[model samples]
Target: MSSFCPNCPDQTIVDPPQTVYENYYHPQHVQVIHPVEIIRQHHCVPVYHHCVTYTVKDKMCTVSGLKKKSRKRK
Candidate 1:
């Protein structure tokens, strides 16, 4: 009645079970809404007319220097 152990030194009694790869991340809660469109452009305000005419022997006449009209804010 003996399972061989006469001062035992034979190596390998139990060694076979290894296959491991781990990466775990779970956190999901998402609500996304994107809608933006704004376009408003209206420009119509420009009227300037200045006419001067003189005939029949004109000695000397000169008038040129007028540019100061810009104020629009509302």
Candidate 2:
């Protein structure tokens, strides 16, 4: 007579998880100070300027659950 097992199954193969990368841009405000010459005053004066800058950001995530779960009753 042959025996059958519910908990134990045949050979199973599992794949490795995949890694995902996402890129985004971030904006930053910067202040610039410079000296300028005036025709009326005939002198140099300090000037303030506002500038916008962008930065690169990287985000990583893992993808899993390639195979479904098995529902077995004991």
For candidate 1, give the lDDT of residue 6: 80
Per-candidate TM equals 0.22, 0.23
* lDDT, model 1: 0.83
What's every prediction's RMSD, in angstroms? 23.5, 54.0
Clashing pairs in 1: none
Among residues 3 or more apart in sequence or in different chains, the pairs in candidate 2 whose N, CA or C atoms overlap within 3 Å are none
lDDT of 1 by residue, 1-74 (tens): 87986887778677697889898989898988898999898999989898999788757755669666899998
Give candidate 1 regions above 4 Å deviation: 1-33, 58-74
Stretches of candidate 2 exceeding 4 Å from the true structure: 1-41, 61-74
Candidate 2 residue lDDT tens string, 1-74: 66975687689888898889898989899888998987775777989898999999999955785766799999
